[model samples]
Target: MQAKEIPVSKSDLLRADLQESLSHSHIDPAQITTFQRIILTTDGTLTEILEAYLYEKIQLVKLSQEIVASAQEIKALDLNIGTNIMNRKVLLQGKISRRNWIYAESVIVPARLDEIYRERLLKSQEPIGRLWLEHRVETFKEIIDSKRELAGELSDYFLIKSEDKLLSRTYRVFSKGQPIMMITEKFPESYFIDK
Candidate 1:
Protein backbone atom coordinates (compact mmCIF):
# COMPACT_ATOMS: atom_id res chain seq x y z
CA MET A 1 0.00 0.00 0.00
CA GLN A 2 1.26 3.56 -0.84
CA ALA A 3 1.67 6.06 2.06
CA LYS A 4 -0.45 9.29 1.92
CA GLU A 5 1.23 12.65 1.33
CA ILE A 6 1.20 15.19 4.19
CA PRO A 7 -1.56 17.85 4.20
CA VAL A 8 -0.31 21.34 5.01
CA SER A 9 -2.42 23.01 7.76
CA LYS A 10 -1.70 25.04 10.90
CA SER A 11 -3.21 23.52 14.00
CA ASP A 12 -2.48 21.93 17.40
CA LEU A 13 -2.61 18.49 15.78
CA LEU A 14 0.32 19.30 13.43
CA ARG A 15 2.44 20.69 16.30
CA ALA A 16 1.88 17.64 18.45
CA ASP A 17 2.85 15.29 15.60
CA LEU A 18 6.10 17.24 15.01
CA GLN A 19 6.99 16.99 18.71
CA GLU A 20 6.34 13.25 18.67
CA SER A 21 8.60 12.74 15.62
CA LEU A 22 11.43 14.71 17.25
CA SER A 23 11.23 12.70 20.48
CA HIS A 24 11.25 9.30 18.70
CA SER A 25 14.16 10.22 16.36
CA HIS A 26 17.59 8.70 17.16
CA ILE A 27 19.41 12.05 16.46
CA ASP A 28 21.35 13.37 19.48
CA PRO A 29 19.90 16.30 21.46
CA ALA A 30 23.10 18.33 20.77
CA GLN A 31 22.64 18.11 16.95
CA ILE A 32 21.14 21.15 15.27
CA THR A 33 18.34 20.22 12.81
CA THR A 34 17.86 22.28 9.62
CA PHE A 35 14.12 23.16 9.23
CA GLN A 36 14.22 23.15 5.37
CA ARG A 37 14.83 19.42 4.89
CA ILE A 38 12.53 18.63 7.83
CA ILE A 39 9.39 19.47 5.74
CA LEU A 40 10.17 16.70 3.25
CA THR A 41 10.42 14.20 6.08
CA THR A 42 7.65 11.58 6.37
CA ASP A 43 6.52 12.95 9.78
CA GLY A 44 6.92 16.73 9.00
CA THR A 45 4.40 19.19 10.53
CA LEU A 46 1.51 20.33 8.28
CA THR A 47 1.90 23.98 9.50
CA GLU A 48 5.52 24.19 8.24
CA ILE A 49 4.53 23.21 4.68
CA LEU A 50 1.55 25.54 4.69
CA GLU A 51 3.57 28.56 5.93
CA ALA A 52 6.22 28.05 3.21
CA TYR A 53 3.60 27.94 0.44
CA LEU A 54 1.85 31.09 1.70
CA TYR A 55 5.14 32.98 2.05
CA GLU A 56 6.08 32.23 -1.58
CA LYS A 57 2.69 33.45 -2.82
CA ILE A 58 2.92 36.71 -0.84
CA GLN A 59 6.38 37.44 -2.28
CA LEU A 60 5.16 36.90 -5.86
CA VAL A 61 2.30 39.36 -5.30
CA LYS A 62 4.65 42.07 -4.03
CA LEU A 63 6.99 41.63 -7.00
CA SER A 64 4.18 41.94 -9.55
CA GLN A 65 2.89 45.17 -8.00
CA GLU A 66 6.33 46.79 -8.21
CA ILE A 67 6.60 45.90 -11.92
CA VAL A 68 3.24 47.48 -12.76
CA ALA A 69 4.10 50.74 -10.95
CA SER A 70 7.41 51.03 -12.79
CA ALA A 71 5.73 50.51 -16.17
CA GLN A 72 3.26 53.34 -15.49
CA GLU A 73 6.04 55.77 -14.53
CA ILE A 74 7.91 55.01 -17.77
CA LYS A 75 4.80 55.76 -19.85
CA ALA A 76 4.38 59.15 -18.22
CA LEU A 77 8.02 60.02 -18.85
CA ASP A 78 7.66 59.09 -22.54
CA LEU A 79 4.90 61.68 -23.13
CA ASN A 80 6.83 64.40 -21.35
CA ILE A 81 9.95 63.82 -23.42
CA GLY A 82 8.26 63.25 -26.79
CA THR A 83 5.33 65.60 -27.47
CA ASN A 84 5.79 68.34 -24.89
CA ILE A 85 9.48 68.85 -25.63
CA MET A 86 9.09 68.94 -29.43
CA ASN A 87 6.97 72.11 -29.34
CA ARG A 88 9.50 73.92 -27.22
CA LYS A 89 12.31 72.80 -29.54
CA VAL A 90 10.71 74.28 -32.67
CA LEU A 91 10.26 77.74 -31.11
CA LEU A 92 13.84 77.95 -29.82
CA GLN A 93 15.41 76.97 -33.17
CA GLY A 94 14.74 80.44 -34.66
CA LYS A 95 17.14 82.22 -32.30
CA ILE A 96 19.94 82.34 -34.87
CA SER A 97 17.83 83.41 -37.83
CA ARG A 98 18.62 87.08 -38.70
CA ARG A 99 15.33 87.51 -40.59
CA ASN A 100 13.49 86.71 -37.40
CA TRP A 101 12.66 89.77 -35.29
CA ILE A 102 13.30 89.58 -31.57
CA TYR A 103 10.07 90.88 -30.08
CA ALA A 104 10.94 93.81 -27.84
CA GLU A 105 9.10 94.41 -24.57
CA SER A 106 10.09 95.66 -21.19
CA VAL A 107 8.83 97.54 -18.10
CA ILE A 108 9.72 100.84 -19.80
CA VAL A 109 8.17 100.23 -23.23
CA PRO A 110 4.49 100.91 -23.96
CA ALA A 111 2.32 98.15 -25.48
CA ARG A 112 1.80 100.09 -28.77
CA LEU A 113 5.52 100.05 -29.59
CA ASP A 114 5.39 96.29 -30.23
CA GLU A 115 3.90 96.67 -33.70
CA ILE A 116 6.02 99.72 -34.51
CA TYR A 117 9.20 97.90 -33.47
CA ARG A 118 8.40 94.98 -35.70
CA GLU A 119 7.71 97.26 -38.67
CA ARG A 120 10.93 99.17 -38.16
CA LEU A 121 12.79 95.90 -37.59
CA LEU A 122 11.44 94.44 -40.83
CA LYS A 123 12.70 97.50 -42.72
CA SER A 124 16.09 97.28 -41.03
CA GLN A 125 16.30 93.55 -41.81
CA GLU A 126 19.65 92.90 -40.13
CA PRO A 127 21.24 96.30 -39.40
CA ILE A 128 22.50 95.14 -36.03
CA GLY A 129 21.88 91.41 -36.47
CA ARG A 130 25.59 90.51 -36.33
CA LEU A 131 26.16 92.40 -33.09
CA TRP A 132 23.06 90.93 -31.45
CA LEU A 133 23.87 87.35 -32.45
CA GLU A 134 27.43 87.50 -31.09
CA HIS A 135 26.64 88.80 -27.62
CA ARG A 136 23.59 86.58 -27.19
CA VAL A 137 25.41 83.39 -28.13
CA GLU A 138 28.20 84.10 -25.68
CA THR A 139 25.68 84.83 -22.94
CA PHE A 140 23.81 81.67 -23.86
CA LYS A 141 26.95 79.54 -23.68
CA GLU A 142 27.89 81.11 -20.35
CA ILE A 143 24.54 80.21 -18.85
CA ILE A 144 24.73 76.64 -20.10
CA ASP A 145 28.29 76.10 -18.88
CA SER A 146 27.49 77.59 -15.50
CA LYS A 147 24.52 75.29 -15.11
CA ARG A 148 26.63 72.32 -16.18
CA GLU A 149 29.22 73.18 -13.58
CA LEU A 150 26.52 73.51 -10.99
CA ALA A 151 25.15 70.10 -11.99
CA GLY A 152 28.58 68.60 -11.48
CA GLU A 153 28.81 70.15 -8.06
CA LEU A 154 25.32 69.22 -6.86
CA SER A 155 24.90 65.96 -8.75
CA ASP A 156 21.98 65.25 -6.41
CA TYR A 157 19.62 67.97 -7.67
CA PHE A 158 18.78 69.26 -11.12
CA LEU A 159 20.35 72.58 -12.17
CA ILE A 160 18.74 74.36 -15.09
CA LYS A 161 19.09 78.02 -16.16
CA SER A 162 17.06 79.98 -18.71
CA GLU A 163 16.07 83.55 -19.49
CA ASP A 164 12.71 85.17 -18.90
CA LYS A 165 11.23 88.61 -18.27
CA LEU A 166 11.56 89.47 -14.61
CA LEU A 167 8.22 91.28 -14.23
CA SER A 168 5.85 90.13 -17.00
CA ARG A 169 7.49 86.69 -16.98
CA THR A 170 7.05 86.46 -20.73
CA TYR A 171 9.61 85.20 -23.26
CA ARG A 172 11.35 88.36 -24.56
CA VAL A 173 13.47 88.34 -27.71
CA PHE A 174 15.88 91.23 -28.34
CA SER A 175 18.58 92.45 -30.71
CA LYS A 176 21.97 94.21 -30.27
CA GLY A 177 20.61 97.70 -29.70
CA GLN A 178 17.11 98.43 -28.39
CA PRO A 179 16.30 95.05 -26.82
CA ILE A 180 17.38 91.42 -26.64
CA MET A 181 15.44 88.19 -26.40
CA MET A 182 15.46 86.87 -22.91
CA ILE A 183 14.39 83.23 -22.70
CA THR A 184 12.89 81.43 -19.75
CA GLU A 185 15.51 78.68 -19.70
CA LYS A 186 18.68 77.20 -21.17
CA PHE A 187 18.29 75.92 -24.71
CA PRO A 188 19.98 73.71 -27.29
CA GLU A 189 18.30 76.01 -29.82
CA SER A 190 20.16 79.09 -31.02
CA TYR A 191 20.02 81.57 -33.93
CA PHE A 192 22.55 83.65 -35.90
CA ILE A 193 23.06 87.01 -34.23
CA ASP A 194 26.59 88.38 -33.58
CA LYS A 195 29.06 86.29 -31.63
Candidate 2:
Protein backbone atom coordinates (compact mmCIF):
# COMPACT_ATOMS: atom_id res chain seq x y z
CA MET A 1 0.00 0.00 0.00
CA GLN A 2 1.13 3.54 -0.77
CA ALA A 3 1.92 5.72 2.26
CA LYS A 4 -0.60 8.40 3.05
CA GLU A 5 0.59 11.96 2.41
CA ILE A 6 0.68 14.14 5.49
CA PRO A 7 -0.69 17.61 4.98
CA VAL A 8 1.70 20.54 5.48
CA SER A 9 0.48 23.49 7.50
CA LYS A 10 0.52 27.02 6.02
CA SER A 11 3.07 28.20 8.51
CA ASP A 12 5.29 25.24 7.78
CA LEU A 13 5.15 25.99 4.09
CA LEU A 14 5.98 29.61 4.76
CA ARG A 15 8.92 28.60 6.91
CA ALA A 16 10.14 26.28 4.23
CA ASP A 17 9.81 28.99 1.61
CA LEU A 18 11.83 31.42 3.70
CA GLN A 19 14.51 28.81 4.22
CA GLU A 20 14.57 27.99 0.54
CA SER A 21 14.86 31.67 -0.34
CA LEU A 22 17.81 32.07 1.99
CA SER A 23 19.41 28.91 0.69
CA HIS A 24 18.99 30.16 -2.86
CA SER A 25 20.89 33.26 -1.82
CA HIS A 26 23.69 31.01 -0.53
CA ILE A 27 22.91 31.55 3.14
CA ASP A 28 22.02 28.88 5.65
CA PRO A 29 19.79 30.35 8.33
CA ALA A 30 20.84 27.68 10.81
CA GLN A 31 24.53 28.49 10.27
CA ILE A 32 24.25 32.30 9.98
CA THR A 33 26.60 34.24 12.24
CA THR A 34 25.15 36.07 15.23
CA PHE A 35 25.86 39.55 13.89
CA GLN A 36 24.54 38.58 10.49
CA ARG A 37 21.42 37.16 12.07
CA ILE A 38 20.97 40.29 14.17
CA ILE A 39 21.22 42.54 11.14
CA LEU A 40 18.81 40.36 9.26
CA THR A 41 16.17 40.06 11.97
CA THR A 42 16.30 43.25 14.03
CA ASP A 43 13.27 45.50 13.99
CA GLY A 44 15.08 48.22 15.92
CA THR A 45 16.95 51.16 14.50
CA LEU A 46 20.10 50.06 12.68
CA THR A 47 21.85 53.37 13.28
CA GLU A 48 21.90 52.76 17.02
CA ILE A 49 22.74 49.09 16.58
CA LEU A 50 25.69 49.85 14.34
CA GLU A 51 26.92 52.54 16.72
CA ALA A 52 26.81 50.15 19.63
CA TYR A 53 28.47 47.35 17.69
CA LEU A 54 31.24 49.50 16.23
CA TYR A 55 31.60 51.74 19.29
CA GLU A 56 31.45 54.82 17.09
CA LYS A 57 28.84 57.29 16.05
CA ILE A 58 27.10 56.50 12.80
CA GLN A 59 26.34 59.02 10.07
CA LEU A 60 23.74 58.97 7.36
CA VAL A 61 25.17 60.14 4.08
CA LYS A 62 22.54 60.92 1.49
CA LEU A 63 23.35 59.55 -1.91
CA SER A 64 20.34 60.83 -3.83
CA GLN A 65 16.80 62.00 -3.27
CA GLU A 66 14.11 62.35 -5.89
CA ILE A 67 10.36 62.41 -6.27
CA VAL A 68 9.11 59.89 -8.78
CA ALA A 69 5.80 58.37 -9.79
CA SER A 70 5.72 54.90 -8.41
CA ALA A 71 4.70 51.91 -10.44
CA GLN A 72 2.35 49.03 -9.71
CA GLU A 73 5.22 46.94 -8.46
CA ILE A 74 5.16 48.68 -5.07
CA LYS A 75 1.98 47.12 -3.73
CA ALA A 76 3.86 46.71 -0.48
CA LEU A 77 3.49 50.42 0.20
CA ASP A 78 -0.27 50.16 -0.52
CA LEU A 79 -0.12 53.33 -2.60
CA ASN A 80 -1.86 53.91 -5.87
CA ILE A 81 0.17 53.60 -9.01
CA GLY A 82 1.40 56.97 -10.32
CA THR A 83 1.40 58.41 -6.83
CA ASN A 84 4.34 60.67 -6.17
CA ILE A 85 6.75 59.04 -3.76
CA MET A 86 10.05 60.11 -2.32
CA ASN A 87 12.86 57.81 -3.39
CA ARG A 88 15.76 58.32 -1.03
CA LYS A 89 19.04 56.44 -0.92
CA VAL A 90 21.66 56.75 1.78
CA LEU A 91 24.57 55.03 3.49
CA LEU A 92 25.04 54.40 7.19
CA GLN A 93 28.73 54.76 7.96
CA GLY A 94 30.94 54.77 11.01
CA LYS A 95 31.73 58.38 11.82
CA ILE A 96 35.23 57.59 13.14
CA SER A 97 36.24 54.69 10.93
CA ARG A 98 34.69 56.22 7.80
CA ARG A 99 33.52 52.77 6.86
CA ASN A 100 30.23 52.24 5.09
CA TRP A 101 28.33 49.71 7.12
CA ILE A 102 24.96 49.60 5.42
CA TYR A 103 23.18 50.90 2.37
CA ALA A 104 19.48 51.66 2.45
CA GLU A 105 16.82 52.76 0.04
CA SER A 106 13.43 54.05 1.10
CA VAL A 107 10.24 54.62 -0.78
CA ILE A 108 8.12 57.01 1.25
CA VAL A 109 4.56 58.11 0.83
CA PRO A 110 4.85 61.78 1.69
CA ALA A 111 1.10 62.21 1.89
CA ARG A 112 0.83 59.66 4.65
CA LEU A 113 3.49 61.34 6.80
CA ASP A 114 3.21 64.32 9.11
CA GLU A 115 4.70 67.64 8.04
CA ILE A 116 7.43 67.62 10.65
CA TYR A 117 8.47 64.05 9.96
CA ARG A 118 8.35 64.56 6.21
CA GLU A 119 10.40 67.73 6.43
CA ARG A 120 13.07 66.11 8.55
CA LEU A 121 13.19 63.12 6.22
CA LEU A 122 13.77 65.38 3.28
CA LYS A 123 16.24 67.82 4.77
CA SER A 124 18.01 66.08 7.62
CA GLN A 125 20.91 63.66 7.26
CA GLU A 126 19.63 61.50 10.10
CA PRO A 127 18.81 57.88 9.47
CA ILE A 128 15.11 57.05 9.07
CA GLY A 129 15.21 55.17 12.35
CA ARG A 130 16.60 58.29 14.01
CA LEU A 131 13.94 60.45 12.43
CA TRP A 132 11.29 58.03 13.64
CA LEU A 133 12.65 58.34 17.14
CA GLU A 134 13.04 62.14 17.07
CA HIS A 135 9.50 62.62 15.79
CA ARG A 136 8.06 60.05 18.19
CA VAL A 137 6.35 58.31 15.36
CA GLU A 138 4.78 55.05 16.42
CA THR A 139 5.70 52.53 13.78
CA PHE A 140 5.44 48.78 13.23
CA LYS A 141 8.10 47.12 11.12
CA GLU A 142 7.22 43.98 9.19
CA ILE A 143 10.14 42.23 7.56
CA ILE A 144 8.97 41.12 4.16
CA ASP A 145 12.14 39.65 2.72
CA SER A 146 15.68 38.70 3.69
CA LYS A 147 18.37 37.27 1.50
CA ARG A 148 21.95 37.34 0.29
CA GLU A 149 22.91 38.57 -3.13
CA LEU A 150 25.82 39.83 -5.20
CA ALA A 151 26.71 43.41 -4.31
CA GLY A 152 26.76 44.55 -7.94
CA GLU A 153 26.63 48.38 -8.11
CA LEU A 154 26.50 48.59 -4.34
CA SER A 155 30.07 47.23 -4.21
CA ASP A 156 31.34 50.79 -4.68
CA TYR A 157 29.77 51.95 -1.43
CA PHE A 158 31.26 49.16 0.66
CA LEU A 159 34.52 49.16 -1.37
CA ILE A 160 34.08 45.46 -2.03
CA LYS A 161 34.18 43.41 -5.19
CA SER A 162 30.99 43.27 -7.23
CA GLU A 163 30.81 39.55 -6.74
CA ASP A 164 30.92 39.84 -2.98
CA LYS A 165 27.79 38.74 -1.17
CA LEU A 166 25.54 41.21 0.62
CA LEU A 167 23.11 40.34 3.35
CA SER A 168 19.87 42.27 3.11
CA ARG A 169 16.40 42.62 4.52
CA THR A 170 13.38 44.46 3.17
CA TYR A 171 10.67 45.66 5.48
CA ARG A 172 7.55 47.76 5.49
CA VAL A 173 6.93 50.43 8.10
CA PHE A 174 3.36 50.88 9.16
CA SER A 175 1.98 53.86 11.05
CA LYS A 176 -1.62 54.59 11.99
CA GLY A 177 -2.47 51.13 10.66
CA GLN A 178 -1.26 52.06 7.19
CA PRO A 179 1.88 51.22 5.36
CA ILE A 180 3.96 54.41 5.24
CA MET A 181 7.22 53.26 3.76
CA MET A 182 9.08 50.29 2.40
CA ILE A 183 12.81 50.07 2.97
CA THR A 184 15.54 47.70 1.83
CA GLU A 185 18.81 47.63 3.77
CA LYS A 186 21.98 45.82 2.73
CA PHE A 187 25.45 45.24 4.15
CA PRO A 188 28.52 43.31 3.17
CA GLU A 189 28.49 39.77 4.53
CA SER A 190 32.09 40.20 5.65
CA TYR A 191 31.42 43.22 7.87
CA PHE A 192 29.86 41.67 10.96
CA ILE A 193 31.61 38.32 11.35
CA ASP A 194 33.36 38.81 14.65
CA LYS A 195 31.85 37.28 17.75
Candidate 3:
Protein backbone atom coordinates (compact mmCIF):
# COMPACT_ATOMS: atom_id res chain seq x y z
CA MET A 1 0.00 0.00 0.00
CA GLN A 2 1.36 3.33 -1.04
CA ALA A 3 1.35 6.35 1.24
CA LYS A 4 -0.85 9.24 0.22
CA GLU A 5 -0.37 12.90 1.00
CA ILE A 6 -2.58 14.09 3.85
CA PRO A 7 -4.17 17.42 3.08
CA VAL A 8 -4.08 20.12 5.72
CA SER A 9 -6.12 23.27 5.84
CA LYS A 10 -4.01 26.41 5.66
CA SER A 11 -5.81 27.83 8.69
CA ASP A 12 -5.08 24.72 10.75
CA LEU A 13 -1.42 24.85 9.88
CA LEU A 14 -1.09 28.55 10.75
CA ARG A 15 -3.36 28.68 13.77
CA ALA A 16 -2.23 28.30 17.36
CA ASP A 17 -5.32 26.32 18.25
CA LEU A 18 -3.30 23.21 18.98
CA GLN A 19 -1.06 25.02 21.40
CA GLU A 20 -3.87 26.95 23.01
CA SER A 21 -5.94 23.85 23.54
CA LEU A 22 -3.13 21.82 25.05
CA SER A 23 -1.77 24.51 27.33
CA HIS A 24 -4.82 25.65 29.29
CA SER A 25 -5.27 29.44 29.18
CA HIS A 26 -1.56 30.22 29.21
CA ILE A 27 0.64 29.17 26.29
CA ASP A 28 4.05 27.70 26.77
CA PRO A 29 6.31 27.96 23.79
CA ALA A 30 8.20 24.82 24.69
CA GLN A 31 5.07 22.80 25.21
CA ILE A 32 3.61 24.18 22.00
CA THR A 33 6.73 23.13 20.14
CA THR A 34 6.45 19.61 21.48
CA PHE A 35 2.71 19.56 20.81
CA GLN A 36 3.28 20.50 17.21
CA ARG A 37 5.94 17.84 16.92
CA ILE A 38 3.64 15.14 18.22
CA ILE A 39 0.10 16.15 17.28
CA LEU A 40 0.79 17.91 14.03
CA THR A 41 3.25 15.43 12.59
CA THR A 42 1.16 13.49 10.13
CA ASP A 43 4.00 11.40 8.83
CA GLY A 44 4.05 8.48 11.30
CA THR A 45 1.85 6.52 13.62
CA LEU A 46 1.32 7.58 17.24
CA THR A 47 2.70 4.27 18.44
CA GLU A 48 5.95 4.90 16.63
CA ILE A 49 6.37 8.43 17.98
CA LEU A 50 5.44 7.52 21.53
CA GLU A 51 7.79 4.57 21.53
CA ALA A 52 10.60 6.78 20.34
CA TYR A 53 9.86 9.44 22.96
CA LEU A 54 9.65 7.05 25.88
CA TYR A 55 12.47 4.82 24.62
CA GLU A 56 10.40 1.83 25.59
CA LYS A 57 8.11 -0.64 23.95
CA ILE A 58 4.57 0.60 23.47
CA GLN A 59 2.16 -1.98 24.83
CA LEU A 60 -1.47 -2.17 23.97
CA VAL A 61 -3.60 -2.77 27.03
CA LYS A 62 -6.98 -3.80 25.79
CA LEU A 63 -9.70 -2.45 27.99
CA SER A 64 -12.73 -3.80 26.18
CA GLN A 65 -14.25 -4.72 22.82
CA GLU A 66 -17.89 -4.96 22.02
CA ILE A 67 -20.29 -4.84 19.11
CA VAL A 68 -22.37 -1.71 19.14
CA ALA A 69 -24.60 0.48 17.06
CA SER A 70 -22.80 2.92 14.81
CA ALA A 71 -22.79 6.57 15.77
CA GLN A 72 -23.93 9.17 13.26
CA GLU A 73 -20.36 10.31 12.73
CA ILE A 74 -19.19 6.80 11.89
CA LYS A 75 -22.15 6.25 9.63
CA ALA A 76 -21.52 9.51 7.83
CA LEU A 77 -17.97 8.47 6.89
CA ASP A 78 -19.35 6.36 4.03
CA LEU A 79 -18.11 3.11 5.49
CA ASN A 80 -20.56 1.23 3.29
CA ILE A 81 -22.03 -0.72 6.12
CA GLY A 82 -25.06 -2.73 5.21
CA THR A 83 -28.29 -3.03 7.17
CA ASN A 84 -26.58 -5.53 9.49
CA ILE A 85 -23.13 -4.03 9.62
CA MET A 86 -21.04 -5.45 12.44
CA ASN A 87 -19.61 -2.55 14.39
CA ARG A 88 -17.06 -3.08 17.15
CA LYS A 89 -15.76 -0.66 19.73
CA VAL A 90 -12.28 -1.23 21.11
CA LEU A 91 -10.94 0.63 24.13
CA LEU A 92 -7.23 0.45 24.83
CA GLN A 93 -4.46 2.06 26.78
CA GLY A 94 -1.07 2.74 25.22
CA LYS A 95 1.50 2.06 27.90
CA ILE A 96 5.25 2.44 28.17
CA SER A 97 7.32 1.13 31.10
CA ARG A 98 4.03 -0.02 32.61
CA ARG A 99 2.72 3.54 32.72
CA ASN A 100 -0.42 4.42 30.90
CA TRP A 101 0.40 7.40 28.72
CA ILE A 102 -2.40 7.30 26.18
CA TYR A 103 -6.03 6.30 26.10
CA ALA A 104 -7.43 5.30 22.75
CA GLU A 105 -10.81 4.27 21.47
CA SER A 106 -11.35 2.76 18.05
CA VAL A 107 -14.55 2.18 16.13
CA ILE A 108 -14.04 -0.64 13.66
CA VAL A 109 -16.31 -2.02 11.02
CA PRO A 110 -15.56 -5.72 11.20
CA ALA A 111 -17.77 -6.63 8.29
CA ARG A 112 -15.63 -4.51 6.05
CA LEU A 113 -12.51 -6.41 7.03
CA ASP A 114 -11.33 -9.82 5.98
CA GLU A 115 -11.73 -12.76 8.35
CA ILE A 116 -8.06 -12.88 9.31
CA TYR A 117 -7.75 -9.18 10.01
CA ARG A 118 -11.03 -9.12 11.85
CA GLU A 119 -9.95 -11.99 14.09
CA ARG A 120 -6.60 -10.39 14.74
CA LEU A 121 -8.30 -7.18 15.80
CA LEU A 122 -10.67 -9.03 18.08
CA LYS A 123 -8.08 -11.29 19.70
CA SER A 124 -4.81 -9.41 19.71
CA GLN A 125 -3.52 -6.65 21.96
CA GLU A 126 -1.48 -5.09 19.15
CA PRO A 127 -1.67 -1.44 18.25
CA ILE A 128 -3.49 -0.61 15.06
CA GLY A 129 -0.31 0.53 13.37
CA ARG A 130 1.32 -2.81 14.01
CA LEU A 131 -1.71 -4.59 12.67
CA TRP A 132 -1.71 -2.49 9.54
CA LEU A 133 1.96 -3.14 8.98
CA GLU A 134 1.62 -6.88 9.43
CA HIS A 135 -1.34 -7.00 7.07
CA ARG A 136 0.23 -4.62 4.55
CA VAL A 137 -2.83 -2.42 4.57
CA GLU A 138 -2.43 1.01 3.07
CA THR A 139 -4.29 3.75 4.89
CA PHE A 140 -4.90 7.47 4.81
CA LYS A 141 -5.60 9.36 8.01
CA GLU A 142 -7.58 12.57 8.19
CA ILE A 143 -7.55 14.39 11.49
CA ILE A 144 -11.12 15.49 11.75
CA ASP A 145 -11.23 17.11 15.18
CA SER A 146 -9.20 17.90 18.23
CA LYS A 147 -9.76 19.30 21.69
CA ARG A 148 -8.16 19.94 25.05
CA GLU A 149 -10.25 19.07 28.06
CA LEU A 150 -9.88 17.75 31.56
CA ALA A 151 -11.05 14.20 31.69
CA GLY A 152 -11.37 12.96 35.23
CA GLU A 153 -10.73 9.29 34.62
CA LEU A 154 -7.83 9.94 32.28
CA SER A 155 -6.26 12.43 34.70
CA ASP A 156 -6.67 10.02 37.59
CA TYR A 157 -5.21 7.15 35.65
CA PHE A 158 -2.22 9.19 34.53
CA LEU A 159 -1.73 10.66 38.03
CA ILE A 160 -2.22 14.17 36.72
CA LYS A 161 -3.99 17.03 38.43
CA SER A 162 -7.69 17.25 37.77
CA GLU A 163 -7.30 20.74 36.36
CA ASP A 164 -4.73 19.67 33.81
CA LYS A 165 -6.45 18.89 30.57
CA LEU A 166 -5.45 16.16 28.18
CA LEU A 167 -4.96 16.81 24.51
CA SER A 168 -6.99 14.63 22.18
CA ARG A 169 -7.27 14.18 18.42
CA THR A 170 -9.86 12.20 16.54
CA TYR A 171 -9.00 10.92 13.11
CA ARG A 172 -10.52 8.62 10.57
CA VAL A 173 -8.53 5.92 8.79
CA PHE A 174 -9.38 5.11 5.23
CA SER A 175 -8.23 2.03 3.35
CA LYS A 176 -9.05 1.01 -0.20
CA GLY A 177 -10.73 4.37 -0.66
CA GLN A 178 -13.24 3.69 2.12
CA PRO A 179 -13.44 4.59 5.77
CA ILE A 180 -12.51 1.61 7.91
CA MET A 181 -12.13 2.99 11.42
CA MET A 182 -12.21 6.09 13.55
CA ILE A 183 -9.66 6.47 16.33
CA THR A 184 -9.44 8.98 19.15
CA GLU A 185 -6.26 9.34 21.16
CA LYS A 186 -6.02 11.27 24.44
CA PHE A 187 -2.59 12.18 25.72
CA PRO A 188 -1.69 13.33 29.21
CA GLU A 189 0.47 16.39 29.71
CA SER A 190 3.25 14.27 31.12
CA TYR A 191 3.77 12.92 27.64
CA PHE A 192 5.12 16.30 26.54
CA ILE A 193 7.41 16.82 29.52
CA ASP A 194 11.10 15.92 29.39
CA LYS A 195 11.90 12.95 31.54
lDDT of 3 at 71: 43
Best by lDDT: 2
Candidate 1 accuracy as lDDT = 0.24
Candidate with more favorable, higher TM-score: 1 or 3: 3
lDDT at 150, model 2: 93
Q: What total of clashing residue pairs does each candidate reach? A: 20, 0, 0
Clashing pairs in 2: none
Report the alpha-carbon TM-score of model 3 versus the true structure: 0.74
Model-by-model lDDT, in order? 0.24, 0.86, 0.66
lDDT of 2 by residue, 16-71 (tens): 54555465666666567777777776688888888888889999999999988987
Better of 1 and 2 by TM-score: 2
Which residue runs of candidate 1 sit more than 4 Å off their true CA positions?
A: 1-90, 94-115, 118-181, 188-195
Ten-residue segment with the worst summed lDDT in candidate 2? 10-19
* Alpha-carbon lDDT of model 3: 0.66
